[model samples]
Target: MTPATENPWAFFDRLYCISLRDRTDRRERARIEFSHMGIEMRVEFVLVDKDHNDPCRGIFASHLLCMKKAIDAGARQWVVFEDDVVFHRYDPHILKDAVTHLSNGSTWTLLFFGCLIKGSSKTGNPRVKRIRYQALAHAYAVNRAFGEKILSQPWCGVPYDTMLRELSDDYLGTTPFFAFQSNAKTDNEACLGLDRFRRCFGGLGLIQLMNEFFHAHRLWVILGHLAVLTGLGVCIW
Candidate 1:
């Protein structure tokens, strides 16, 4: 009675990873992770030296460059990864489920591998939920159409991930997310003028665990927060 879902990968054409030439550490980590997951991908270079400019511009340009290359290479759907990507709960079978929630014969514009996304989905498979936008972009898939749309947008010095946040439709994400960013030095801190490898609270394992739970039961977590807020309100009254 429902359209049989296909693994999100079923919809992709090719995978590409964006990496800065100097960050061999991140590239190596991603390489090992992919080898473990049986992922094959091409590497795209982020040649911009983000030190002198707003790093967001460099990020946006890097993403656009990858998209251009993918489209040029005849890939209608492309999956892009940053070197910080860390896989979780990956199974080949999770690759075969379908998550088409748009409409009859409609397709998604963007699909997140890991993100701090907002909202829920009752229509699609629970494992594949529709979402509003990405708070993070370590990993995601994009259709050529949406990729072109993104390319068309003016960077204007805004954080590229912030630009992603304004998208409210045609976005889908996996639950128990297939990947997340590891606690590695990244633009998350560099953009703030912080030094590389900033020590995160509770360390890398804690960060990964937080993403695991959030991806698995984000709605419940949101509701729990709301309940606590309401209880506090009642106590104050």
Candidate 2:
């Protein structure tokens, strides 16, 4: 039996729908969609509580805290969702199976759907097969062992991509990491909105555009745009 069959709601259990204070509707949709599917999950609003003036670090810190909470709850598997993601043609069963495949493989340090498609340069260990970029936390899952591995790693004071690169190189070297292919051909991304991050920040230069296109996995761009716009949030709810 699958994990969801045992718990019915196991896929959604301990899921944290990370969002800003202004994104109540986005949170609501994510929460309701999962609930309707008999997946027990909750939405927790997150924002900088104080005027620290550091938006980037604050967001990462909040994610770490929420992830720790899920781990503490004895969650063997957990999903992290950003506000703007909407599953148009997604089947919960298929998603569950995909996650199970990665988890059961046991060689991967992380399983995510968003990342830049790149070739792996660091080659030493035979455990890993190849390297690709763009694994975003949005709509991603981490097995129990992966959680522990991440927790044990030192927190790097950089963007999520840099941190993932470092972690993949050091820990998951040569391991196969499953990340989503973002183009229209991979999956039916009907509800997926425009790639705003590429439009906004990517215009600085070719290197910058290429870097963001492949590195951040564009999940943050989707979620960040959702938070900024109240009603424009794409949702699975």
Candidate 3:
């Protein structure tokens, strides 16, 4: 009898309707191209009503749903991303190698697949573990154990990156987290600037609000997005 093939990753994509409105064709082509490269990835469009009043809620809702779906798929190890981020043209094997490295070597609750920094700084940077933060959910990898841990906790009502910062001290070198630094400046598509929120609250306070929101709402902060979008728009329904 033939042996059953090992289940590939239960990949999750933290997509937004903006992708559909902005770049539908490129997105579809990218998905197909990645698949052809032998990366068993799946895109889960975290739909939120374009009319959902608060854009922040829509964005967060998408990620929360994406996390839940990844867990429901029985994903032990999964990669999460926003549709805006682009991948390197390098061989697919190289990408897979990086994923394997993070998966096996670190206990990082979340591994940034891409980073968008300008110069070199010693702040929370990884050497052998390189993927630095350049954009929002550019690409993050997670394990089922970690996924369950984060999911079980309330959504911290803040961007995922900041959320990691608070938890970073807890898992310093113990968790092998990284960010991609090479294509930080040149790669526009790969970077995530969150133009929407920037237009609304143009100041550092927005970040502060996010952090405070996460602290206050905790899980509900995260879960609120799920309900807001799911109710306002179509999602993991």
In each prediction, how many residue pairs overlap at the backbone (N, C-alpha, C within less than 3 A)?
A: 7, 13, 15
User: How do the residues 1-237 of candidate 1 rate in per-residue lDDT, one tens digit apiece?
Assistant: 232454445456678888876777777888898778666444443444553446677888888887788878888778888878888778655444533433245567887777765555643566567776646787888878888888788877677788877744667776656787776655544444332322446434355457556755877999999999999999999
Query: RMSD, each candidate, Å?
Result: 4.7, 13.9, 16.7
Candidate 3 lDDT over residue span 71-115, tens digit each? 776666666555444444344333444444444555556655444
Report every candidate's CA lDDT. 0.68, 0.48, 0.44
lDDT digits (tens) for residues 167-208 of candidate 2: 654222112232222222111132123344433443212332
| CA error at residue 216 for candidate 2, angstroms | 18
Off by over 4 Å in 2: 1-13, 32-52, 103-105, 119-131, 152-155, 169-197, 200-237
Top lDDT: which candidate number? 1
| TM-score (all chains, Cα) for each model | 0.77, 0.56, 0.51
Alpha-carbon lDDT of model 2: 0.48
